[model samples]
Target chain A: QQQVKQSPQSLIVQKGGISIINCAYENTAFDYFPWYQQFPGKGPALLIAIRPDVSEKKEGRFTISFNKSAKQFSLHIMDSQPGDSATYFCAASSIKAAGNKLTFGGGTRVLVKP
Target chain B: DVKVTQSSRYLVKRTGEKVFLECVQDMDHENMFWYRQDPGLGLRLIYFSYDVKMKEKGDIPEGYSVSREKKERFSLILESASTNQTSMYLCASIPGPNTEAFFGQGTRLTVV
Candidate 1:
């Protein structure tokens, strides 16, 4: 069973527009939600993350809006740029089992056209 | 900055060959992980080590084994390489359970 499900396997957005990627989880025990960005031939890097307690968390141009009741979280990129084009992955994990057992959603490839 | 390094960027092996993939981290982190990325399946964990000489099986650990003799180095061994094992393997390390993980560039393994 896929613990986490992500939408829009591929997305195309114009530069300066907003880009959004959504993910849903079935496990209520999951407390940590993180998004990762991966470029071709490179490993994934942490982009932004949010805990269950917070409804929204923003860092610079990246924002993570989470709905605990809905069991959904989405990553919103403000003023998307061509440099932001990469594959994004949404992951969920519980603090008790967070060592390296993150449940990842199928990646979404985003293309920001300049 | 934390740095995780995989020994090889690319590797090729025969079906019956024994393969070893080595990973080293500079950050003195206590946790290390090995995951494989496929075209549509995304990243799936194979094994992880919480500390020296300690290992845990991840979701997919059927054809893999891990060894952590030192705190900084972790190794993944394939007893017998198979064509299905061909994929991009990534190594990661985290300071603690609640913290973010740093990843290596990844090693692309191709089994013939």
Candidate 2:
């Protein structure tokens, strides 16, 4: 079963507008929630991450809003630009003796029109 | 900067051919992963290795095998190429399970 579920497989926003993507998980043991951004030809890069202890974490134009009670999280891009168009993935992980095994959501493709 | 490098950017192979995709990390990371990217499917883990000479199957390990002979190198082997296996393969390495990861540019493999 897919542990993490993401919504809105694709998104489109105008320049200067806000772009949002949502994800939900069934496993509460997950302590780390990270967001990754991928360009057309490049690998996915770390954008922002948050833990269950905090409700929100912001980095530049990218923000990760997490709700521990609801078992849900969302990524918000403030003043979205065309450069922000790319694929975004939300992942959940819990550390283990060997290492942390991450479960990723399907994905969200974002398009910002300038 | 920590980096993960995949051997080939693009490769084309014939059916029934044995295909090897290599990944090397300069970060000396203990955790390495192999994933395949498809439209809408996101990144699906195929295999992972936590240390040298150790490997574990991930969510979609069917028809795929992996090797971690050394700490810095992780290889994914396709016993026999199939058209269905055509997709972009990505490799990632992490210092620890919960920390940030370094990813490779990806290898676009086409099985004809």
Candidate 3:
């Protein structure tokens, strides 16, 4: 069974708009949440990550909104641009011993139109 | 920069053929992982290792095996290739929990 679930297999956004992708997890042991971005033919790279201790994290135009009580997290891309078009994946893991085995969501393909 | 190199970017094999996908990391990370990527299905872990010669099975370990003889190298093996096994395979390494995992370019394996 998939421990982490993501919605909206794909999305389209106009330039300068905002794109949001949401994910949820069932494992209460999970405390680390991260988002990864991947371009065509390239490996997925780390975009941003958040710990349960924080409610939100922002890096430039990318922000991660996390709700620890709800066991949910979302990635919001502000001022979406064509260059921001890519596949986004949300993963959850624990930092305890034998942890860090990332349970990834289904993934969302975002297309930014100019 | 941390580099994880997969032996091949693309590979083709006949059904029933035994195949090996090799991966090497330069960072000497203690943890290594093998994941299978499929559209809509997302990335599924096949196997992982925390130390050399120590391995743990992931969600989809059936029909697949792994080897980690050295600190920097992790190998995925297909005991008998099948058409259902054709997919993109990715290798990743991380220093430890809560750390970034560096991934390889990935290997597209096609079994006919």
Q: Once model 3 is optimally superposed onto the true structure by TM-score, how far is the C-alpha of residue A57 displaced, in angstroms?
A: 0.2
TM-score each candidate. 0.97, 0.98, 0.98
Model 1, A2-113: lDDT tens per residue?
Answer: 7899887899999999999999999998989999999998999999999998999999999999999999999999999999999999998888884646888888999999
- Candidate 1 clashing pairs? none
Error of 1 at A45 (Å): 0.8
lDDT, candidate 3, A18-114, per-residue tens = 9999999999999889899999888899999999999999999999999989999999999999999999999988887373688899999999999
For candidate 2, write residues B3-109 as lDDT tens digits: 89999999999999999999999988999999999988889999999889888889899989999999999999999989999999999999986999889999999
Query: Of the native A-B interface contacts, what share survives in model 1?
Result: 0.61
Residue-wise lDDT of candidate 1 within B1-112, one digit each (tens)? Answer: 8899999999999998999999999989999999999865778899998989989999899999999999999999999999999999999998876569899999999999
Top of the candidates by lDDT: 3
- Look at candidate 2 and give me any clashing residue pairs: A100-B97
DockQ leader: 2
Ranking by DockQ: 2, 3, 1
- Alpha carbon lDDT of residue A26, candidate 2? 95
Relative to the real complex, the DockQ score for model 1 comes to: 0.70
- In the order shown, the candidates' Cα RMSDs to the true structure are 1.1, 1.0, 0.8
